[model samples]
Target: MNLESLVNLAGEAAVLATGGLLIGMAFGGFAQVSKFCLRSAVIEFSKGLLGSKVAVWLLTFSAAVVSTQAVIGFGSLDVTGARQLAARGSLSGSLIGGVMFGAGMILARGCASRLLVLSATGNLRALLSGLVLTIVAQASLRGALSPAREMLSELWTVQGGPSRNLLSLVDGVPQFGLWLGVAWLACALWLARRARIGYLIEASAVGVGLAVGAGWLFTYSVSQVSFAPVQVKSISFTGPSADTLMGLINSPSLTLGFDTGLVPGVFAGSLLAALITREWKVQGFHDGPSMWRYLIGAALMGFGGMLAGGCAVGAGVTGGAIFALTAWMALAAMWIGAVITHLVVDGAVAGSVLAEPLVDQSSGR
Candidate 1:
């Protein structure tokens, strides 16, 4: 709050931001190259297609779990100490929020991270969606809509012992983490081996996992050194986006944090990749209908993400890494929501939304 305190906070934020920048760039480049969209993966799986992207996502999740837990086992990180991972979690919030976010991604035609990448690549539609997402998410977190989120979270919250992770529940059974990680890795390997772009997919999957796992380590390390109140978190777009936008007009106290750096880092990293790969293009709304759809969809995602405690990357990957029940349940709910949206909006019956051309354009080795 004072001048000296402000200077220290700024220095700490700068150091944390540097780490975030490196992680974001690595993730962005890989995401662009592999076209790793969570929405696309859900759609593809629902459509009965065993896609490589899904495999890559699973591999990343497994790797993150393995690496992060190893750190916890070695006393390097304390995820359970984080408020979000407290013993009590909101089941209803996760379900409702996941459903909303999943359906919204379908309507918006992309997830939060996808929009971030698209925005960096000069997509006007994504830019608008990003802005809406930031504003709405902020509202849900601390503004007018926060009451609704709190009510839902309180109504259905449940307690799960001293710690919510699988290891703790099972009394720190070492083999559980080992087997879970192995099973996931095995499935990912099988998927990668069967894909047309096997080698590329495998490499990208490993890179994404390393990036995510390393991000947790970096942030945790910074938290240790700062003596300031910095939360231990990894790659999550919803809160970070809102924090970045709000931090602009507010005091440094509001803006100086890990999420603040991460949101912009993702965009900057994606922009760098787009330029390097010559994929940057200025795209805009095709008409009024598209604009309206994006606005509604972004708002939905914003609300859902805040209520559920994270977006696709947040709950899906980061939360999943720690074997959190909330993450898995939310992910399942999101997938179901996406399926229903595809059926009603796309007018598809008992099939996936991923047609061949859509796959070609969105995903290619």
Candidate 2:
């Protein structure tokens, strides 16, 4: 490329990176402030306490679905363009990987996104889990386990293009999905208000949804106008963690994109929050057994994320927002996996389902 072309490329990449960073930071801050974790949601739900956390989770998703559909309706994006929402959706990957991801999150005491935030807050145990999760996820994506990944994906994958989303199934009537989301959001809001949910919880949940929606909008905008080959995507920690690591180690040959910017941005945002809150402190494992458990948890999460084609955030939240079939499948499978782990491993998983409003993280990990 010529000098002008190189400069233009750099400028475009910068813009895209900036958007990704802002999105990541928003999510990081929201998650940190809210102590948001799918594992926590499952645990609390299992305990029969349909608390504010669950309200936050459902509202966040409903908001995302509504916002995402708005973007698509405005002709700014297409759900089918998303790799995860592509024509060929893998059922096996969703089922097996989701199950593993759920169990792993419980074992590690947090999901992939939760660990990332915790790691930034100087939790050495989370740091270790994050590292192992990254390595194992990378292996599953492109390393030793890639063959198995391919085999499973191919074996159970089905034609999902035509029915990838509600809009597509309804032949471009995105209003249907939008209305559906609105109805869900209305119910969520009613429940949240009835429970007297706190402002922080509601704001954080909505903000996270906006962040996810903004990611799709920004990436779509960049891909639409940028001359360079840019991949359109939203947030997902598993692949992005690997992509970021590769970009860091091989900057001369590697081109940093949305993923590279996002992963570090999340860490930076969480780090900033930790610093401001005076929560940064070393927290390594207390014993070898605990360390081994974390290691195993990381491996399961990594393999499962790759097999499922995305982690909790990737599939459950991002893909689910767009109404992807695989995402819903994975979300259910992951939930089942968590329930099983809680029943068998966590011993009865019994607790009262309190009707508390979603509020602060007074009782969180």
Candidate 3:
């Protein structure tokens, strides 16, 4: 059927969006407050100062696992919608793209999600990065190099892999899948304990991560029911940034689409918490040189993510957490990309603790 026939289920989309918004706000707020930054986490780990960033990382990761699965168990796991684990999502693209994305993150001093929260927190560099990221993402989606990306996907596609949604495997034989997920949960908990995050930070990390996972499950379970059975999926920033425009301009073109859309949720969620905490702060730009640096870093990140197919949060948290091989490829690629960016820009691959508000070292996975 056509697009209009699908989105006609306005209420379902609204629920999905609402769930996503809540997740976004909580994630943003947690990120803003606890500094849940992948860039900082990695940088610090690389630099040998892995004290602070560890707690939040494990917390967020655990939350993603538990909450996402809960949504799945109820048959709400929208394997089709999230756009992350889809068959069309290429392995080579995820690997190369992630490395590039990660390297850019290392250079730009944060991951895509971190960039968003950092921009909100008055980091002019991050603000510029966000702007550049948006533009480059737009171009990559349907711009000059899109044909290249498409061709690349056609060329290096991996065989024998489950060429459908990544989450499908987990849903198929849930007994084994649940065990794996349990192992994941155990590992996250173990990491938290080992990190000595105490109670508050660990709790916060789990809270934020699980909330996001629930958003995924909500979309998969809630939105897919209609005149026709549609596949559900999770969230990712890249395509959605491209898709956000599609939603507005092409609303008439869609009968139904994935409902969870996490990026929008994070933005809205973060803002709500920020406002509630009286953090309705509006950040501004710095001087020209700083702007240039931010733009350059963001451009690299955009291209990297374009190649990788998702940002750190997309691959690292959402996909990687779900145990998608492609997601891990992207995450590794992202880290590598960030490191490459750092090598080219600052001439140092790793360094000391954070000197600026948004410039902490990288955290652990």
Candidate 4:
């Protein structure tokens, strides 16, 4: 399948691009309705509560994993959409980057993907965080910082792959998923709601959401024919962070990856949802110090996501949902980052910063 043939039959990259937008829209809607935040979810869970928000994350995962499993089992998934699914490289970024993104998410109020969803809901802090995230992503990809980042990764990487580490158990299903599901199940059991129509409906929706997201991402990733400089990508938060920044520009080419548009779609979807619910409002920090929090937090999330190679959805929920080993490592690091940030920064999960100049003492900033 040449690019020209793909262009004619699969509508070239048009279908792929649309699929990306759909992903953005689905998450955006989930964001608006659920107010989901992995950072907060972890915070609450650590504080002795399964709560509703955490379930949103689990329900989201349940939906994604079931859908992804269906896709792969049905011969519709390519298995290459996920970075660690079928690619080769040291899992350095997955582990280290996960910690970074996780911690930064705690500081920034949410992961990069969460920021996109929150920005739609009038959170000025998230909006500013998104900006910082974009700048750092570009810097990480290629800039003055690339050499150092690359060097550090080379120094610590070890040879590891997902060949038979856990296949001994099921000879199938991702190990990460198996463990995460166990945790999720435990939490779900504790939070068992009274049997009610509303509860069942919400649960079903969450399941559907997870299934659809994982299925689409996995399937579309396999469908990609553009394989020259690199393998096809499915769900990722780093490049999308850069692309989101590009869209903020006044003169971007408008002809880029679907990720470039997905962020905006998330925001737009959230904004519309908020408006219809009469919840839209222009809100923000109360002072310069608060603004500084937002800035530092956002920058941290971008850098962390880059280091982890994904964001909340890309890493925590998406990668974690799939039961990838790296996803598990990233989640651990993210939890560490979040806990440390909360204890060291200001005793606040959502660092109260937006657009003011950053404070230098913040974590990894």
Candidate 5:
């Protein structure tokens, strides 16, 4: 539908919400089928095993980078005003928070987006952990934990604009971002081929990337058409999840926007996919220790995501696709943290007969 038609039909808020819902559904479904999880990829890589998990993650990341850069190269999108690049960002927060988030995901057995997806697939452990994550996220964003987040964010700040944009650093290179994406895509393809990944899985991984690109395009389009100011944003779960949860709890009337619609849309889409594939089965924590581990992980993710300004998918993929400096830093920090945590935590209990499984059964490992 044209922009004018959409605005006239349900107003700006509705239009944004609708766009988020559609994009979120695509991401959720593709992610479910592809078994895309950053934690898994990190684990596989840390163990020196370049397996299907790593291939799927590489494909998804490369796809997002390629598609988003392709649009920018074609002059269809301008992300200069996006929060990741436009606003003052924190280097300290990105590093510290990224590490925390990585370690947290290792313990939780999922990232923010993965928890939401698993919750939809009848995983009670995920559902509970997701709830804790949301509540803690809300607390971190505006409640008691906000001060700590703010303090970390202020430790080292970079002014927005060209400084935050990676492409801007390499001035005069025509479509440098696009070429970078292409290189990554080539690597992803090579890895996928070596893993002998099926076409359907590969396509689904690409779909996840396309969904991220669509989010950028859709929001930008809405901003152009709407009379009011609209933030041009793509997929990210941290702030959105907190906003959604708070809207449900405190607001008399929920604010209608991209974030308000994203969480639920992802949940619904994942649920649909699970049911269709007969993957929907109730699963819960197998023991008290496992339950504590999940809750602790959820808490860490919530606070860390808020402090870092994004979660695994939020900062790592969505922001990284745009070549935001802090996003890349955060992504690197996450890898370091995940690898270290796996080696220390998982390795500590590796030889124990009573140690919990390395991969959660419900994660489709």
Candidate 6:
């Protein structure tokens, strides 16, 4: 259906929400089948292994970059008004928040989107963590933690427009983003081939990327045709999760929009994928310590994601696709933070365990 027809029939908000639901479903299904998790990719890379996880992540990232850039290059989408580009941004918040989110994902064993996908597959740990994340995100957005988030965000701010656009910063580089995406796609394809990843998995990864691109395209299309003001945005879990949670709590006051449909759409899509693959199996925390770890991690992710203005997929893939400066910074910070945390927590623990026997001899154990 055309944008105008759909908008006329269901209203602009409903159309946007429907579009979000479809795009979110695609993302959910693709992510589920591909096992696309930035946290896993980070852990694998930190361990110095270029394995399937990294390959899958690269495929998704490259595909998202390529698809989004292609649309922009063809003049099919204009992201100048998107919040990632148009609004004032925070360098301090991106750096600190990205680091916190990365570390939290490691402790929680999943990122925001990953947690949602896992929760649908009967992971009680993920479900609880996701709920905690939503609550904390809501708190950070407008509740008890808003002041702190605002304070940190104000520490370092960048004006919107050209400054936020990384492509604009480069001089005389024509179609830079498209070319860069092409190069990345080539690399990803090579890695995927070398790793002998299944075709289905690779395709699913690409599908996830396409879904991101679709989100941008769909929203922009709606904004162009609708008389009502609609925000041109793509997929991002942080704000959407908080909004969705609040909508659930305040059903009478809920407003329909893209974000209003995204979370539930993703959940439903992931659930369907899991059921089809017979991967739906209930799982939960094994101990109190682990439960506490997840809770703390979820809280950190919630606040950090809100502070950063995006999560892993949000800033890393969606915003990165458009080459937003803060998004790239946040993405880099996430990788760095994940690597450092992995070394300190996982690596250090392993080292200590290995040294335990040597120390036991000195203690005559």
- Candidate 6 Cα misplacement greater than 4 A, ranges: 350-365
Give per-model CA RMSD. 4.4, 4.9, 5.5, 5.7, 1.6, 5.5
Q: What lDDT tens digits, residue by residue, belong to model 1 across residues 1-365?
A: 63345436667777777678778877777777667777777767878888676787777777777777778777787776555576588889889999999988877778888888788888877888888998999999999999999999897876754545656678756657756877888887888788765676577666667677777887777777676767777888898888888887576565456666677777887788788888988877655655666787799999999888889888888888777778777878888887887666666432322211122224411
Superposed by TM-score, candidate 1 places the C-alpha of residue 261 at a distance from the truth, in angstroms, of: 1.6
- Candidates' TM-scores? 0.88, 0.89, 0.78, 0.79, 0.97, 0.95
Which candidate ranks first by TM-score, i.e. highest?
5
Question: Judged by lDDT, which candidate is best?
Answer: 5
Model 5 spans with C-alpha error above 4 angstroms: 351-355, 359-362
lDDT of 5 by residue, 1-365 (tens): 77888897889999999888988999999989888899999989998998888989989998999899999889999999999999999999999999998988887888999999999998988889888988998898889999999999999999999999999878899889888888988888888989998998899988998899899988998888889999999999988998888888888888999987788889988888888999998887777766777888899899988888899999999999999999999999989988987887788776443235665643643
TM-score of 5: 0.97
TM-score, predicted candidate 3 vs. hidden true structure:
0.78
Which 10 consecutive positions of candidate 3 have the poorest summed lDDT? 356-365
Overlapping backbone residue pairs in candidate 3 total: 54
Ranking by TM-score: 5, 6, 2, 1, 4, 3
lDDT of each: 0.76, 0.77, 0.61, 0.59, 0.88, 0.86
Model 3 misplaced regions, further than 4 Å: 1-10, 70-86, 159-174, 190-198, 228-231, 245-264, 275-287, 343-365
Which prediction has more favorable TM-score, 3 or 6? 6
Compared with the true structure, the alpha-carbon lDDT of candidate 1 equals 0.76
How many Å off is the CA of 301 in candidate 4?
A: 1.5
| Residues 1-365 of candidate 2: C-alpha lDDT, one tens digit per residue | 64345436677677777777888998888877766678877987898877776777777888888898888777878766788766578888889889998888777777888889998887877888888998898888889989988887777776767565545667756378778888988887876777677887787777777788888888877776677766778989888887777666758654657776788788888888777777777676655655665677788899999888788888888888888888888899899998787666566432312111222121222
For TM-score, candidate 2 versus 6, the one ahead is 6
Instruction: After the best TM-score superposition of candidate 2, give how far the Cα of residue 275 lies from its true spot, in angstroms.
Output: 2.6
Candidate 3 on 284-329: residue-level lDDT in tens?
A: 4433444555565677677667777677777777776556667777
Q: After superposition, how far is residue 293 of candidate 3 from its true place, in Å?
A: 2.8
